[model samples]
Target: MTPEFGSRRTAIVTGGAKRIGACFVRALAEDGWTLLIHCRESVAEAEAIAAEIGNGARVVAADLATVDGPDRVIAALEGMPPPALLVNSASLFELDSHDDFTAEAWDAHMNANARGPALLSRGFARAVPAGQGALIVNLLDAKLAQPNPDFYSYTISKMAFAGVSELMARVLAPQGIRVNAIAPSVTMVSGPQSRENFAKVHAMNALHRGVDVDDLVRALRFLVASPAITGQTIAVDGGQRFLSLPRDVQFMES
Candidate 1:
């Protein structure tokens, strides 16, 4: 029998073309969701995922680093049912220290990681039916808990988004929309790292292990299925946030 679908069973995963974003998209798709996989440049990969899923999954390409990005995604909701799950997973992770801050870097990070998520959250809340329950999950870095100067601009933007997550939860709960975040550790090979270094860094956490795609999928599934888990930020980072690291985990033992 074919699966039943509804707006309340729909999801939009930003940056859902590759990497962790694509992982989220696949997870939700497997759990029987009508997907709107949003991508920026990785259109081919996004299309492939959509084609593979074959569940009315659409690929939306928009610059989540701009104000109009949310509009395009929201507009795609027309005629189709509004998404009940909006994963703010797109981000600009560039290197910038406190001493090297520049307007370009700041704007790019703020727009993509902070402003874009906030706008999309608002759009998602509005699209959901009044007093109908829905969930919005933000993908944040575990480093936000252990603040650092490395990736300064990216850190600041994520910090801003963290604030938005809680505040939006409080503000949107009246509409029955839940807002939460998942802060994951060094889950993937990011930035500049040799295979050896990546492996070493991955196990530096308290659990001597790294968070993985399945771990995040579990957290997201919990938030989506739970009826009373709002304003919460779940760290699936093997206790990385509990440590007092002065720099990013990758640079800690280097």
Candidate 2:
């Protein structure tokens, strides 16, 4: 007999419709997880992925930048079984040179990237059953370390959330819920602007190469599966952190 959605081991993956999030959804699905994929403007893409996965896959639409978005997602998953995993993979990334930054920009970046994940993490902690091995994986960026002069707000928000990974892990670990974060360097598979951003990143890395999105998804999979690890920021960058590359290299290359 097929299990009901409530009966299956499930995960709520925010922004699981496309790109790295979609890759994460595919990985979790292969692990036999029922997916509640939360997407903002990517409803059609989310639905398409749900259909492809075809077993206990559901799509939720919400602008996580708002105050109520996290609650709405939790409501959808509440009917499911007690043991649930929450992947806080949704984030807003923008690059405004320091001089171009505005109050609206600061709030917008904080809301979507930092506040939303914190809200979701709190909700998941309360919702998932005790001793059921629940996990929350926050998708962070290596930009937190490098400090993008143009993308300060976005990077700062991510750094804040990255710090929370340890705080939540310490408290939640006793409850059988593990909280960890992944800080990826620029990935090869985003958009045109992102590609350009990554080109700069590739040159910055010690290896002078870009990283595959698949490698990041794999790290996420390991984080979700390993109960022994928690409160860690796993860098998926290809040794980029060690190298102190100059920012002027980007301007010169351009």
Candidate 3:
């Protein structure tokens, strides 16, 4: 983008339809940002959130698991002022242990969780003006620090993304773009997890508390306002990384 072109106070959040993604969308909106809520198939939820925020937040649709998804998301920024922030909050968290893992499932997880965010960060860096200083915050999992066999594909994909964040931070620092990540512990229910299991696992951290939407909002705000911090992952997992759980908390028997 040319220096002559000014940027908007805009942010794009992938998977901004529900869960923690939607929470970030609302938080950014409240911070006076024009939100571009990106969703794959949950367009209705995205639209609902947009309407609730009443800030003219637009919903962009793209399956990040597909080849054209990142491009499609980046294309939405065309004709509009450049976005100041890009939150790679969308992820594929399907269950596939090592014993049951398949190439198809692994590829699917990698495409959506790692490759898509990496490409989106690249596109976002290019789209930003020469010195506007943009930030890309990727959502990661705390389980990555002490990985278990549970959700093997998902864990591997996040590991790849963590590496992507570090690499991009080094390459983009001179260009005034910062790439960072946040590792959140299990805050919400996962696939097929019963309420009992969720409660039991949510407290399995050093702080005895799980990550929350407020924790994420605070972290993003700090990153957005801080100009000196880059290439670092701030763990908001309530010290979950310090513990060594043999299995993902979800699978631990009560």
Candidate 4:
């Protein structure tokens, strides 16, 4: 059934053209949210998603790494009713060990994961109307909790963004805007060794499992509607965060 525009809410979810972001968009679409889906390069996928959602849904292309990109996205919704929600789901995850990390790599990580969301949150608060109170959900990672030595820059960047989530929550609350986050452990995506990594990561979870995208979508919906909850980072990590491994143990021995 085509969603009713009048009853529909609207949300702008960055990096929402595919994967976990797409899952959230689908859930929100089903819940009657007309989406402003954002992507940096996935135009075809974004269009496909727009077609699928079909409830006055639209797509915007914005590079989170550029200053102009955030402004362009915010401008696209100008004079329209303020979106009821914003999901800063766009991010860059790259593996850079400390010794090999370049200035370019560090800037990319900080800009995409940390600065982009902060800029968007600033825009959302400044633009969204009061009494209508907007919700913002930033998709963080469980890697922030247990820093991966290999993925150094990505983990550090997310850790900074996670802190920004809390700051936004406290500062935005006075304006009736709620900001929160969901940190996921292992989201099954693909590559040659992806399945092996997925299995290893899934086993790290106390539940001995990995979560499907649907699980994250559920968490997003709850946070969106839950006015009382803000500034918190919920670990949708299948209890993986609680598993304390012995750091001193050598990987070769294990």
Over 4 Å off, model 3:
1-7
Candidate 4 residue lDDT tens string, 1-254: 12211344578889889887888888888887878889999989999999988977888898978887888788877545457789998889766677899889989999999998899889877777656667889999875666556566877788899989999999988887888999987676532335555555554567867777888888987786676888888888777667654321111121
Off by more than 4 A, model 2: 1-7, 189-204, 246-254
TM-score of each: 0.94, 0.89, 0.94, 0.90
**Of models 1 and 3, which has the larger lDDT?**
3
Candidate 3 residues 183-225, lDDT tens each? Answer: 8888789877899899878878888876778998889888887
Any residue pairs clashing in model 1, and if so which? Answer: none
Q: Model 2 Cα displacement at 133 (Å)? A: 1.4
Q: Report model 4's TM-score to 2 decimal places.
A: 0.90
Residue-level lDDT tens digits of model 2 in 1-254? 01222346778899899888898898888877888999999999999999999776888898888999988888878565454678888888766657788899889988998888888889878887654667888889875665546466776778788877778988887787788888887674342354565465455567766778788978987876676878888888777767644442233243
Give the backbone clash total of model 4.
Answer: 0
In model 1, what is the error at residue 160, expressed in angstroms? 0.3
User: What residue pairs clash in candidate 3, if any at all?
Assistant: none
RMSD values for the candidates in order, in angstroms, are 2.4, 3.6, 2.8, 3.6
Per-model C-alpha lDDT, please? 0.85, 0.77, 0.85, 0.78
Error of 1 at 93 (Å): 0.3
After the best TM-score superposition of candidate 3, give how far the Cα of residue 51 lies from its true spot, in angstroms: 1.7
